[model samples]
Target: MLNDFSPAAAASSFSPAFSPPEVSQPAPPTFTSPAAAVAAAARLAPRLFEQAARTDEVGGFPTQEFAWLRETGLLTAALAPALGGAGLGEPAAALALLQVLYHVGRGNLAVGRLFEGHVNALLLIQRFGKPAQVAAYAADARAGHLFGVWNTENPAHGVRLNFLAGGTYRLHGAKTFASGAGHITRPLLTGALPAHHGWQMLVLPADEQPPQLDRSFWRPLGMRATASFIASLERLEISADCLLGQPNDYYQQPWFGGGAA
Candidate 1:
């Protein structure tokens, strides 16, 4: 049976540890109507699919196509209405995202998957962040800035995070298959601090350079446009502002975990 991921289902499945702690007020929905958002998604779905082939071959981002995404206001659909977003609930937003992924996958699965990650990051900020944080990210998203999550943990204790004395955090390990790394303006990266309780995510500016980036590692049979390159961080300096939320917000919930793929 095709799973119907409704709001009630989401609430029931949400783990208490991962849930947002009690606050004074609840945030409002960003989308007004599910039907309107789905209709809008349908319009952009075909074009994204049409360009998927070329996007894959070039090992580059579908920049122009994403520009169209911005024009359609689909990019800001995850933000709350107060932050100038569509104000749709999670179920409606996920449905729209599924539609986008379906079309993108028709020509290039890589692009579709990458787009899914981008949307997921936006959803994360919308859900767990403070008002100021949401406003900042929402503004950038509305202005056509792209974002994505960069967490590819392996089964064998692959990744580790370290905290330095000078208010800088270092990522000791490597992240493989960082989809849309090259094209994303912002990367929602996840790593753990040494001796810390859990993992933390940071919104790293994409302009920052990693100590070691091997382009050849990305040479693959498919999904070339994704630029899923391997990058190493001996000791990257990330300011405090780079941190996304409180120490445990990243790994707490499965809501931020699912990708369109």
Candidate 2:
């Protein structure tokens, strides 16, 4: 049976200990429906394709196309209206998200992957984050900030979270196969808790301090523009509010397996 871990339940379990830094909000979304968003994506596809060859040849991050995506308001469409988004409500959200991904995927798989991660991060926040957290992240998203989910772990140096004084946490070690490494503004990462079993999920500024990226690690023949790299988060301090849910929440039985499916 799938475990029902609702946002309200998650919020009730933890109290906010800090607030995210303020961010200026962007202009209102230009498109509201999936069809309109997809249409806009279609209009941008050719330009993205034009840069695909170079982006692949460079074998690094895809920067130019993302600017177009942000300008078109495709990145913030999935967010709820209360959070400064286009308000593409349910029964249609899945289809809308699918269409957006499909159109972008047609232009470049690497960019599509990054965009998919961004959407996943936003959904996780929407599902488990408190109201303040949601609003803050929404504003960041609206302002063209990119989000990513980096869960892959390194066997040699497993990611760990150390509890600090005053209810804060510090992240040590690194995560491998982290996509959009340098470019992802806020990334949802997983770390094992010190002296505690299971993992914790956290959202932090990926580039707040320079992350150690092993550029030599990714040499894929395809999806070269993804910039998937090894990021060392040694001694990265995380405020209490950045922690989502509770210990073991990340791998919580049916939710991790079933909900993801």
Candidate 3:
């Protein structure tokens, strides 16, 4: 079982040096079309596979593999050029994105899961987030920050987004089956607001504090490298800028409620 701890206690356990360093911006690559993006993924296949085998055996985080992804610029290939990505222009952008994911999945399912979430986070920011939010996250991706989404909640202690007096918010409760629990830089999660009104989506730095992890919660024999864990987030302060879409936006129709799923 994952024991909950106060924010202060969690803060005390972490060293400042554990925080990820700020990454410098790298020059964006130019991709004329979807085919170009596919080719790049093809070139990276061997390396991704080589690392995947080791990660699966170890059953921990794939840190070194992630670094390789960052260095190769394959992590941000799905974003638009303006966002410092390899410009995989549309009409075939969706197909191109799928191709990249397929190749990555072939190499390693766990890393592929993380990469897929990263792409989803970028797409969410592109579609619903404010201009500034989009730019900030895009810059982070360009700087090699990995993103993920964690929506699973514990029924006994569902996650809540409580509005604070200072115009900020604090998270309470835990998310279960959270993949890349410790390694993901920016993780997008959903929680219910007060009064049972609606849900809200927010992004926060996963490594800011040492989140209590129930490592044993994940016992799958396959994709063990994912490092999925139960995360207890009790009284975790959240900045105003971290809020992504509006309340209940996560369940909106046509996109989520409709056939798009």
Whole-model lDDT values for every prediction: 0.61, 0.71, 0.71
TM-score-best of 2 and 3:
3
Q: Write the per-residue lDDT of candidate 2 for residues 1-261, one digit (tens) a residue.
A: 002212122211111112222445446456756678778878887887778877884445677777778778877876876665555434456676677788888888888888888877887788778888988888788777788888887555768888889998877777778888767778888889877667888898754644566655677876767878677777778788888777777676644653354
RMSD of each: 12.3, 9.5, 3.5
Q: What lDDT tens digits, residue by residue, belong to model 3 across residues 59-137?
A: 4667777766666677677677767676442434767777887887787788888777777767666766899998888
Per-model TM-score on C-alpha atoms: 0.75, 0.83, 0.85
What's the lDDT for residue 254 in model 2? 46
After superposing candidate 1 on the true structure, give the runs of residues whose Cα lies further than 4 Å from its correct spot: 1-32, 88-97, 103-108, 154-159, 208-212, 254-261
Residue 245 in candidate 3, Cα distance off native in Å = 1.2
lDDT of 1 by residue, 1-261 (tens): 012212122212111111111333323224465455556667667777677667666446566666655566666666666666665436646665565456545545775566677677888887666677778887777666677888884424345667678887766665667666556767787877667667787776655633344445576656777777554544557777677787778766566446423
Better of 1 and 3 by lDDT: 3
Error of 3 at 46 (Å): 2.1
Clashing pairs in 3: none
Q: How well does candidate 2 score on lDDT at residue 255?
A: 40
* Per-residue error (Å), model 2, residue 247: 2.7
